[model samples]
Target: MIDPVIIRTMKTVKEIRLENARALANEGPAEFARRIDSSTQQVNQFMGPSPTRNIGDKLARRIEAAFGKPEGWLDVEHITGSDDASISGTRSAVLEKLLPEGSGNLVTWETPDDLEPDDERVWIDRYDYRYSAGNGVIQWEVRQKKALPFDIGFFKALGVRPQDCKLAQVHGRSMEPYLFNRDMMMICTAKTRVKDGLIYAVTFEDEPLVKQIFKEPEGALRLHSYNPEFPDKIIAADQLEGLQIAGEVVYRSGSGLAGGN
Candidate 1:
C-alpha cells in the first residue's frame, strides 16, 4: 500500500498525464504542433527568468521555436532579439563565461558555427500548480521545493524549462495500486487547453488536483479516482478559477511505483 496522501496526490497526477498521451495520439501533426506552440508561449510569458535569473535571448527564441512557430517566435511574427534581447550571442559564448571549459568539473565546449540556443532540461520532480476548486485557473503555482514534502533529485538533470523537454508528477490515489505518490510523470507539455476524460491539473475549491478529468452532463468537469472508495467529484467551469493541464503523463517512475526510491 502507498501513503494515502502520496497515493491521493499521485493518482490525480498520473490521470492528467495519461489523458495527455491519449489526446496527442488522436491529433494530427499540424494540430498538435499548433497546440505545442501555444503552450510554449504561455510558459515563456508566465515563467520568465524566475528569481535572479535572466531570460537569455537565445533560449527565449529556442523555446519559442520548440513550440514550432518561426525560429524566433510562435505567437509573434518577429524573429527573436530586440535591441535588449540581442545583447549577447548564443549558449556557446555564454557558457564559456560561466562554465569555463578549463574546469574539468563541467563539460567543456566551444561554440560550433551551427550551434543553436536552447532551454535547460526541466525535470518533472513534482507538479506544484495551484487553482481555485471553485474557479480553477492557475491562480497560483508552486514547484518541487514548495509543494513536495520530500526531496526529489530529478531536478539536477532538468531545470524547469522547455529545454528540459518537460515532465510532470503523479499526485493522487484515485488510481490506487497503479499510480502512487511522487511518481515522476513524463509529459510532452505541448498541450494548451483541457480536454475531457483526460487527467489534468484541476483546482478544486482551493486545492489543485492531479486528477483524471472527465466532462459532466452539466458541462462541468468530473474529477475521478480509481480506488472507487474515494468519491468522484464534479467541478463546473463556473466553479473553477482556471485549469492548468500539464500536458499528459507519458512516463511513470519514482517512489510510489518503483518501491520507495
Candidate 2:
C-alpha cells in the first residue's frame, strides 16, 4: 500500500511547483516543458498535484533555471509568507521577491514604473490584424504594420520578450464594459495557456474574438463576456478545430495606444 503521509507531501510539493510554473510563465505543460527542454509527459507526471511523484534534484535545478529562480528555490518543503484572502499567497510572495517594487498585483499584470537604468528597450511590430470585439465587422489581415518601442523590464518581469507581443486594438462591445471599443490591448503571443477566467484573443470559426475562456469539467471551452447583455458561448472539445489563440491579453489601455517610452 502507498504511504498516505508521503502522498500528502508529494501533493503539497507538486502544488507549489505548479503554482510557481504558472506564475513564471502562465503557460501549458507542453510549452513550459519545451522552454525547460523537458518532455511534457515528464512535467505532467512529476508536477501533477494529485500524483505522489517526487521531483528529482536534477529536474528541480532545471525548473529553477528555466524560471530564472535562484538556486535551491525548489528545495524547500514548506513555504511561509503573508497570505491574502483574495489572492494567492504563494504567487504573491514568489513574485514579490522576483519583481521590483510596485509590481504587486499579478492578476492585473502590472509592471513597476521605476525600472532600472540597465533595462533595455526594443521596438516590436504591431501587425495589421484587426480582430473585432463586437461583431465580425473588421478585416483580419496583416496590413499597414508598424513597430513600437517598449521597455524590456515590462516583459522580463512577466518572463517574456517584447518580440513575443502584439499591439492590438479592441473594436466591439462584446467584451465591454471592461474592454471598450477602441481600447488598446497588449497581447502576449507566447503565453498561450487558456487559463480560467483570463482574457484572450482567439480566432473562433475564422472570426476573431476577445473573451474570457473557462475550461469546463467536461473539457469544453466556455467563452465568457464581461457584459451581462451578451450570453456565454460554449465550444465543445471536438469543435475546437481552427481555434487559433492569438494570445493572452496582458495589458489594456482605455485612454489610447501604448507609445514609446
Write down the TM-score of every candidate.
0.36, 0.47
For each candidate in the order shown, give its overall lDDT on alpha carbons.
0.44, 0.66
Candidate 2 C-alpha lDDT tens digits along 53-84: 55667777888888788887775533344443
Task: Give model 1's TM-score versus the native structure.
Answer: 0.36
Q: Please list the residue runs of candidate 2 whose C-alpha ends up more than 4 Å from where it truly belongs after superposition.
A: 1-119, 131-140, 255-261
lDDT of candidate 2 at residue 136, scale 0 to 100: 38
Best by TM-score: 2
Error of 1 at 88 (Å): 60
The best candidate in terms of lDDT: 2
Candidate 2 structure, TM-score to reference? 0.47
**lDDT value for model 1:** 0.44
